[model samples]
Target chain A: MPKQVDHEERRAAIVSALWKLAGERGLDRVSLRDTAREAGMSLGQLQHYFATRDDMLVFAMDFISKRTTERVTARVLALDERTPEAILRMCVAEMLPLDDRKRQGSRMSISFYVEALDNERLLSHAREGSRKLLDFFEQQLREAQDRDEIPADRDPRREGMIIMSVVDGLTSYCHLGLHTAEEALAMAMRHLDTLFGAAHETKR
Target chain B: MPKQVDHEERRAAIVSALWKLAGERGLDRVSLRDTAREAGMSLGQLQHYFATRDDMLVFAMDFISKRTTERVTARVLALDERTPEAILRMCVAEMLPLDDRKRQGSRMSISFYVEALDNERLLSHAREGSRKLLDFFEQQLREAQDRDEIPADRDPRREGMIIMSVVDGLTSYCHLGLHTAEEALAMAMRHLDTLFGAAHETKR
Candidate 1:
C-alpha cells in the first residue's frame, strides 16, 4: 500500500492555516480563497474538506478549543503534586501568548469573541470554551482548600472567579498592548502569588 | 450677541454620532457618508466638523478615550465620601456595563482599540486611555489600603492590575453573552467583596 496521509492531520493543517489568515487580517476579512491559498490547497480542495465557511469557522474555533484543553490537561497530568502553585502555573501558562501559534490563536479568539457579540450560535461555542477555563480554575481552588493550602473558610467559587477574571483580563491586556505577552504573564503570576499566598488565609 | 453654535458641542455631537454608528456596525464598517447621514448632516457639513475619514477616525477614537476618563472622574467626584466602601462602590459602578449607554460606549472603545492596533498615532491614544484607567484603579487601591478597606500589605499595583483584568474579562463575557450583564456583574461584585473584605480589619 502507498503511504497514507492522515485525514485528521490534514483537517488540522487547514485549521492552522485558517487561524494564521484570520490573525493577519481580521476574521471578517479572511475568505475561503485566502485560507485555501494559505493552506497550499485549491479552493475546490478546501471546500471539499470544510463544505462551507461556517463549517470552516466552527472547525477552526473547536480546533483551538481542543488544543488548549489538551495543553492544560497535559500540564496537570504531569504535575507531581497539584498545589495551588502547581495548578496555577499550568492554568496561567494556558493564558499566556507564549509563541506565534498561541498569539495567532489569541487574535483569532479575540476576533471571534467580538463577532460572537452579534451571533448567539457563535457565542455558545465561545461560552463553552470559557466555561472550561473557569472550571479548571475553580477545581484548583477547591483542591487548594482541601489541601489546606488556603483557609477552609474562604469560598472557593468566589476566589476562583477572581483568579479567572484576572487571567481573562491580563489576556486582553496583552492583545490590547497595555503589556507585552511576556510582561502580562509575569505580572499576572506575581498578582496570583499575592492572593493565593499571604492574603487568603488572613481573616478580616 | 447672536448665539454661536459651540464648536465643542458640535464636535461632541459629531463624535457621538460616530460612536453610535460604531456600536451599530463596528468601526471598520462605518463610513464617512453613512456617519454624516446618521448624524443628520451633509458630507460638506461633516467635513467642516472633521476634514477627512482619517481625521474622523482619529477624532472619534480620541473622543472615546476622553469620554471614558471623564465618566470615571465624574462618578468619583460626585461621591460624597472617600470611605473604602464608598470608593469601591463608585469605581466598580463606573467600570460595569449595567446600562445601554455604558455598554455601547465600552463596545465602541474596544472597537477603537482594535483599529488602533494598526494605526500608530491612535495606538498611543488608546494606550494612554488604558494606562489612565489602570492608574485610577491603583489610586483607589492605595486609598482603600489607607482607609483599611484592603490589606495594607497587598501590592497596590498588582491588585490594581488584577482588578482591571477582572473588569476587562467580565466585559468580554458580557460582549459574548456568556452571562447576562447583571449576572456577570453580580458574580464579579461578590468576588471583589471577598478580595476587599478579606484584607480589611473590619469583621462582620
Candidate 2:
C-alpha cells in the first residue's frame, strides 16, 4: 500500500507554493494552472483538494492566517526577562521584511489584502485575520501592563490599536517599493521610541 | 441645440455616482459601466472622459482625496476659538462614521485600500491620501503641544500614526459588515477617550 501522505504538510506545501506565486506577481494573476505547475503536482491532484479558485484562495488565506497566529503564540510563550518595549520591538520587527521568508510573507499578504477587497468570499477571511492580530496585540499590551512595563492606567485596547496602526503605516514604506527593509525598520524604531519610550511608562 | 454640457459638471456627476456606488457596494463591484449607467450617461461618454478603467478608478480615488483635503483645510481655517484638544477631536471625529457622509466615505475608501496594496499604479494615490491626512494630524499635534492640549514633548509623527490607526480600526466596524455603525462608533469613542485621557492634557 502507498504510504499515507501527511495531510497537514501537503496542505502547507500547496499554500506555500500558491503564496509564493501570488507574491511574485499579483493575486489577480494567480491561477490553478500556475499553482499546480509551481507545486509540481498533477492538475487532478490540485483540484481534488481545492476544486476551484475560490477554494484555493480561501485555504491560502487561512494558511497565512494560521502561520501568523503561530508567530504571535510563540512570542507570548517566550516573554521572559525582557521589557515590554523590547519584546514589542522584537515582535513587530519580525513582521518586517528583514529576511527572505518574511519578505515573501509580507509581499503575499499585501497582495492578498488587495484581492480581499473586491472578492466577497475572501473579505471575511482577511477581516478575521486582522481581528485576530489586533486581539493578540491587546493581549500583549495587557501582559506588558501587568509586568509593569506600561502604566496601569494606560488603556490596553487603545494602545493596541495605536501599535497596529503604526505597523500598517510602516508596511506602506515597503509597499511603495521605495525604502530598504532596514531603512523602514529604522524609521519605525524612531517613531516607536517616541510613542513607547521609557519616559512614557510607569512601574506597577 | 442641446445646452452644451458643463465639462466640469459632467465629470463631477460621474464621480458623485461612482462614490455613491462605492458606498453602496464597493470599489470592485462598481465598474465604469455601472458608473455610466448610474450617472445616466452612455458608456461612450464615460469612456470619452476616463479613456480606460484604470483612469476611472484613479479619477474616483482623486475625487475622494481632494474632497477630504478641502474639508480638513476648511476646518483648520475655521478654528478660531476652540482649544487644540477640541480641534483634534473635531478633526478625528470627522473620520469616524458618526454621520452618514463620513461612514459612506470610509466604506468606499476601505474598499479601495485593497486595490492599493500591490497595484504600484494605485499605491501612490493611496499614499498621497494618507500623507495629506497624516500631515494634518501631525500639524495639529504640534499645534496642540504649543497650546498644551497634548504633552509638549510628544512626537508628532508617532501621534499621527496612532490617530491614523484608530481611523483604520474604525473602518473595520463598517467594512467588516459585522458591527453596526453605532456599535463601531461607540467602541471607537471609548478607545479615543482612553487615549486622550491618558495624556491628561491641560486646559486651553
Candidate 2: tens digits of C-alpha lDDT, residues A109-177: 756665675678788877777777668778877887786656575677656655665566566546655
Stretches > 4 Å off in candidate 2: A1-6, A28-34, A52-54, A69-85, A97-100, A110-128, A177-204, B20-38, B71-82, B99-101, B117-121, B177-204
Task: Please give the DockQ score of every candidate, comma-separated.
Answer: 0.64, 0.26
lDDT of 1 by residue, A48-141 (tens): 8888777888788887788887888888888998677687877787767878778777667778877777676777887887776677677888
Judging by lDDT against the true structure, name the best candidate.
Answer: 1
lDDT of 2 by residue, B47-69 (tens): 89998777887888888777876
Model 1 bad stretches (over 4 Å):
A1-5, A198-204, B1-6
Q: Model 2 clash pairs?
A: A114-B114
- For residue A102, model 2's alpha carbon misses the true position, in angstroms, by 3.0
**Candidate 1 residue-wise lDDT, B27-134, digit = tens:** 878888888898888989889977877788888777766776687678777878766566666677677788988888778877776777667777777677778778
lDDT of 2 at B99: 72
Clash count, one per candidate:
0, 1
For model 2, give the RMSD to the true fold: 4.1
TM-score of model 2 (CA atoms): 0.78
For residue A31, what is the lDDT in candidate 1? 85
